[model samples]
Target: MLSTAAVSWKEPNVECSIDIGLCPNIKYKHKTAQRRLTLFEDFVAFGGVCVSWRLVMAALKKDFNMLPRVPWLMLAEKDDGSNLRDFYCPMKCKNIYRSMLPKASGKRFFSSQGWLLTIAADHEVNLLHPLSRVQILLPNLTTFSNLEEMATHCTDKLYHNFIQKAVLSSSPSTTSDYAIMVIHGAISKLAFYRRGDNAWTTIETWLSAYSDVIYHEGRFYAIDCWGRIVVCDVNGSCPTRGQIMPVMPNEFTHSLEKLYLVESLGKLLIVLRQGVTTRDDYTHGTTRLRVFELNWEEVQSLGNRALFLGFNSSFSVEASNEIKANCIYFTDDCFEAYYSASFADEGAPNYHPEGGGKDMGIFNLSDGSIEPHFRGRSFDPLSPPMWVTPSF
Candidate 1:
């Protein structure tokens, strides 16, 4: 007959089994012994590999709970002449964070891995984490000898004439051995810099006028205005061009307003934005948003993911049931037609002078439909709305 203690062991949380009818049976002893032996075998199997199976389970639960509930989109606007206010996603809420940038003249050029890449008026690049108020300053713009030559080429606006975008290989919090790549020069040259490097090294490539650059799979890939992709190895003193991706479709290369490269789900994607020139300004009036996955010799569909495009950064995430797949969320910048060149002196190339027509919204890829995300808020031209993925 099984003992009362053994019966209690069979009930995980019960202090004791009250069923006297089954507890006194000798068969119950065999069942309880077999169950205990199975549990012991499991513990013995996993014990050699880890300190405790319980601890591993606890650590996994903690990590799963730490995942963000929802990603947020970030927008920057001028509160006064010098101060900038940051608005979080789902704009109806009162949650807004302010920038810690010392100079109001700074412009945001890139955002990734929970950092905002900004260029100050004095031509210093800084990485700022708005949520944590952490910042890192890279080597100054004049440190690059090639950039100095490019500056002399356009002496009137030396600082503003170069550096369209910059991207980092990894987050500074993760490792100290990170690299930075920038699309610089009037003709769109690629420049590379590592954490310990003294100056930026310009990569040699056949393509001219790059629209965007992204660091993916331990290397940097850039897309030119004509939708050509070039690969660069950043390990060398100067980046070496590795291979050019397959030529983009004629529809993507012709009349392209802007090109963006984003890494999602272990695949590289190119976002081609096409718009029409309206009067003196460019209006994205019926502009089509097309996303293509870059294969070895051809392009494919994006498949079940939504892309967010901005001047500083572009990213993709799996679409939930609520948010349909194959759609794009975008923000207005200098590439859009409503942007005026007269606002260039107002601080940063993206800054808007009139502070109207931020043109922020979502576009559906399945069907041609556009939905505006923000309705009543007015944003600064210099600090237009941008999509920011929240990270710690």
Candidate 2:
């Protein structure tokens, strides 16, 4: 006979948030080296219980890896039965807006050229400046899409089609910004939204089957769901002029999914991902992260470590200034898949979002090692440090 007692997990406060800034005298458990950030408070540490270096090293030894001083975000259970909340660290203005967003999930905030672009699947697109709260809704996207029937097709396609790639680009013209969106399913099309133009332009030039897109030099290079890469010059200055450049042959297993045009230490990087092969000879559909150099001299592929991206291949790649440590910051998801229990679908075979929400990490390009990221429950605040460069 079995005891019929109920098993219940305790709910935590889930109250934590981070204020990205610089701090001095941060000492980690494993090393005597005290590192400092060029951007004073580049990163803020959230929700971690600091322990002694001896214990940290001991933990790493057992895990066969070194422990990082910073954590991306931290999670805590809510005291009540309601939803979880985040209390960000490195501290901040204690504004209502900061409290509204949990440490793990939200639309990514992108700031550039004095303008900030905010996107959330559930919310209206917003363009603003961080210093100022006045935001404007991008002239109704549906209204413009409906004008050409592209909206109807696009709306219908969203339910069936998968988002293979979506990236933001600034053309050399400087007058406009675009969102380069590509989809994979029955067919493929290269879609771009010109800011000032207020309408989307779709191109059926490349077969929408494969995956990967990166802006390198003056062109936007995309790898489709069919394992073919097409490079287009947004500047229209190349000899090929919008011609897709065919490089590596597609004898490999699964189609390519990601590309990184990483500019590090004065070098341009081209990182690609190919699926992993299984022992039974069936492709597991897991992607292996590969690196390359993109320069006029000779493009060279670097590193052979196969990183397990852990999804059926829906992911996003981004880079942050590893200012002090020479690291790379990747969001892993367009949506905040890192948090939110409601978004997770356990019944699905591959229970993960393609573009957002997986284990986000920072790879040290200098040493070829993956930094410890997304520890504890939510992202540790120290994880995504503020990338502040001295203005003067």
Candidate 3:
């Protein structure tokens, strides 16, 4: 269905295995001045150096509402294994469907390009397409050196639970030469695996721990707990780390805040979540929000783009009349201690006691105001909610 070529880059004394075979020469059928459409067109050409044309067309067609309906978030009831529901806030419509894979009891760690990265009970990793019911099993968790030792000591489950996030280099729907990168281990080590790799290659970094990662501009950029950014070359024999970006100034005192990295309008952004801890249960309630654009190692304000954050994934969509600019729609799952404890049930509904109020809400960047998005409905703290962009 597609053609391929072998592309190799050489750096003196270093081994590199970068694959650019899937990178297609994209052509536009029509020209338009619309900024969103132009941006999407450029993203297809330059975002990921190895993205296929089929993947680009599929993503753009679905995202731009060219299909019957634009994709919306799907919330899976944790306890119910038989059905899944789609929540469309813009259309105020809800559609229920049978579970695509009822036997997948793994906790979802990341979502990107219409794929969900999950870890099963036996510690196996998979990229699942919920609508198509397609699953790609990646290198098992036991393939990691440290995790293997933990498995030998009967503590693999405890260590495997540390993997909180993952991202795909390219959508598997169109390319078989994609890679999966994940942040795992007790101290948050970075590792990546390609399609044919027998094991994941870990990238060595000086940072103590990493918070989030995103693939942008032909490389992987990750943020540490202390707000430091590290870039990685994923295709190398042993993925090497590039220079660290400057850290942003701290404005909040709470140590429980969450950090996320998202690509918006061809630029990279770092979002910081500020919250207050309840004295009794220690659950977090968002108090303020801050967004900064990473411009050549400096941080600036994010202009005109609204961000969406959740445990499954973080991404940016254009601001319209319905979705205001300079705001964040966040879910309840912040990967807190209480929620992690419920992984045994694969983050089933009501695994932990409900907190003070629903954690899903919208935060305004200009005035620091918080408002509930789903009124009067409290979500399970452990299960939280995931923002799913449908693809079929």
Candidate 4:
């Protein structure tokens, strides 16, 4: 139970109401008084972690641009690594649990239709509603494992290297809708999950491509390693078995490292990242950020933009470098992107020679500049991680 106190403020011909929550001296806008009153009165847990509570309220004001109205407690992974615990934030905190799922390392969450799709390690996927915590696991199951004998025999591990990238998308078919995931390893595999039936089906081919999966215009599309942009007609009644249609005018191939899909200007936009060539003098390294229209006609590079920070200006032009990308995220408006500096090539001698510029940063395409945000671990190790949506 939370004890409550109210403070009334009066100024020259002005009056206001300040409703108190667990935090002291906290004031609320008078017009939204009822909401503020409810938050503190209804949800304050005396024994809860105070830092988490304050952090949640601060995040709500910063990210959502809304005042803390009602304190809504949510289940979250504790910063102390104590599994899951109940913590409260302003009622409007969006998808609080979504970021926690990855740390749990038990289920993965993908968002669609205002619900989240959660898949266990075994590929047992479930659809969950974030607020209500309602879940329905899809019945279909697909498991991938490398051959034990071959894995053990080979000095270099290749089996676990089956697919370098995995993404999920929901496509509408004439009969119904399904979730399509593109798995790219030594082989390219398209796996489909039928809703209501809870089953998974896979189609394999020698596309041997690494690309980002994009859901657009009721279909799924990707630019393969060969720079061939392929689009699959998801509306097909049966499992996708026919030839995939090519929509791009020219085959554009690059050592694409990252893929991002954004729906903009009434069409789909694909952003691809390719390694920059080093000059013979080895003065600077280059990376390309390519944007393609849905029709795959006009492809343009953002021009020497360092998509990942650590690789900027360090490598010799002629030398080959495998750029690693940490996590990639986009703002809600999709006009900007934020990527982590850590790459996959941590062991390479010249890797991140610049000490990995910043842990995380923000990029605004409008200005073509990146603002780095560096937070030391001691600041707030358990500060709630950003948005994690439950799968439904």
Candidate 5:
């Protein structure tokens, strides 16, 4: 009661407007002293809190110096409702954060290791690192070989589903001395673009459909649908015919088994997954899996390492305490999704008219149980959810 007479009349909002958080110089000094290896997304989330955090974000935007963080479960683009694409930062946040990515609008996405490859409606191809927003333009889809053979298909339809996968010899951020390889066309014909090339140079493996490609050691190794590997070098005026490795037999019979070629702990592996396409609803389900080395030795344990495979580039990670060890994390790589997005007039089979996302989960080898990775609406046909390893 006595405070009314003694207290001064001042506006709290106006008087307390100055930043109470750390000063810019102090913030930066602490950052330097701690030397914390911060995640790109984590810094973004921290920016919304106060003025000093925003300064940190500004510093990050100007100079991004961090390695790839834990794999983020980037969900599919939403329906016509919003531009916000949701992502689940697995080991970092364990929560969903929505981001507006207009650059990816209406474009097909393929992963080149940690980076993303986007194909525009005009057939313009671009390699984009989403976190860093650094982009490199490659020759368009029309530049690929055998375009004359696909005269019947519309340009939109052909370019949308043409690229099966893309792999980078080295990250474009670190150095310019690198090469890019893409498995494109209906038959998965392999092509490469190097540091000094104007157009793509095809490696005439003359094999069946290729599923995956990886750059290991000093050469590029590409595996086809029938489990045959062709090793080719990115040297010479034109690539000599690819040297064929002996075909590894797929004990599990599916049209195109052994989709992922992953090199973990200096050991190359063939992950065999058998899934049947139910044309009724396009609900593809996998029941059996075999992850084995190229020498036909079975992998019984992964120790502290985890493997991630999907529509994006397949890679392995050393697990932290927050993440599960010896678990295989997978995402939606349903080939039917592309046809559904591109082949509207071509009488493509409808995928679950119910309008829901595809199947993605983690399989524990020790327990043989499956668990959901994310519970987001990732049903966009043109651009589905994929595993994105964040890098700057």
Candidate 6:
């Protein structure tokens, strides 16, 4: 179990919450630096424990790996009867936070640029910001283009299952001129919706089986399963067709293929991640890396920078910013592909969704060393935990 438990970030009342005072021996613990990790949800409540602890917290601000920090792993919510969500800081502090989020009840979460897209049990959709706690109602996606005949199947959760992946052109909190795109349906397809739009407009394109989509250079780019890309300018109701690029060279194809599209510096990149041969485990571990430039050319390195790749918005950061440079921080994105508990047959393998989270790690690009990013409970199948960059 993690050091953290179910605790509210809110100011606790005098009845239930206990105040933590800094003892005279705290200096000795601070000097030795061997104390157990202390977990709290909010800095206000945490620092307000006592005057001495407040001063201690103020002095610890230079750690640079705490809450309100960017690139946090929004942990997968467990049914621990807390009715709260968890967020883990993986850089240095290694602190786990539990927050009361009633709006997220029975909802699956998808993230992009710190904004989360919540799919309710009844198929209602909403965009939420965790830090600001802002909610924006998006058009409910209860239907798909290819699966027109929904009478035979269960209506509620069937449509959401078809949604393979989603990404944003920009966060709504930052700009009004932003778009929401998703790859959905039985055969993966691209769809987009702008702010204040009542309906999601499906992009008319022949290129299908898209695994991932990313917004780069003012256009939406979707990558198919066969390493092909389609760049299209998503607009109003009358959507335009995307210009499909030629199939990329399949030089790094393997058994379980995964590709991510991201903007490293000022250039577009397609990162290919395949399994290692020596490993016999069912969980996918990344060994080799094949990075490509947008011009169909291969690149050598991401100098002085680190990449955060997962279900959320894939982004790159400068290593000078106290971040682990040239490492890929990935989460439990392979859960749906590997574990389908709801869709499994009677005699299918007993694969749990939480088991696939073991694949989450930091893969060093330089020497290819893989290390655990977060040590905690595994993730849920539908709304697995992922990398979320706070944009406040």
TM-score top scorer: 5
- Per residue, candidate 3 scores C-alpha lDDT tens digits across 179-292 of 877888777778888889888777878786887888887788888877788888777554656558877565432453677898888878887777633335545567776666
Q: What is the C-alpha lDDT of each candidate?
A: 0.59, 0.35, 0.59, 0.35, 0.68, 0.67
Candidate 2 structure quality by residue, lDDT tens digits, 1-392: 00111211132212222211222234435434332322211211111212232233223232322222221122232334433333222112211112222221343333322233444444344554331233545533342322344344445323222233344454212334444333323344554444564644455554554445555555566655444567665435442234655555545324445544444444445555433222243223323355554432323322322121221111222222321233444434322122222233576333232332234455554564555444433322111211111100
- Location of the lowest summed lDDT over 10 successive residues in candidate 3: 1-10
Q: Which parts of model 3 have CA positions greater than 4 angstroms off? A: 1-71, 78-90, 94-99, 103-106, 148-160, 250-256, 276-281, 295-303, 340-351, 354-357, 376-383
TM-score of each: 0.72, 0.48, 0.71, 0.49, 0.82, 0.78
Model 1 scores worst on lDDT over the 10 consecutive residues at: 1-10
lDDT of 6 by residue, 138-184 (tens): 88865445457334446766644656677888878658888889977
In the range 163-187, model 5's lDDT, one tens digit per residue, is 8788888888777888888888767
Better of 3 and 6 by TM-score: 6
Error of 5 at 195 (Å): 3.1
Worst 10 residues of 6 by lDDT: 13-22
Return the lDDT, model 1, position 225.
79
lDDT of 1 by residue, 314-352 (tens): 677777633447778777654334444534545545433
lDDT of candidate 3 at residue 309, scale 0 to 100: 78
Scored by lDDT, the top model is 5
Ten consecutive residues with minimal summed lDDT in candidate 2?
Answer: 383-392
Q: Indicate the TM-score of model 3.
A: 0.71
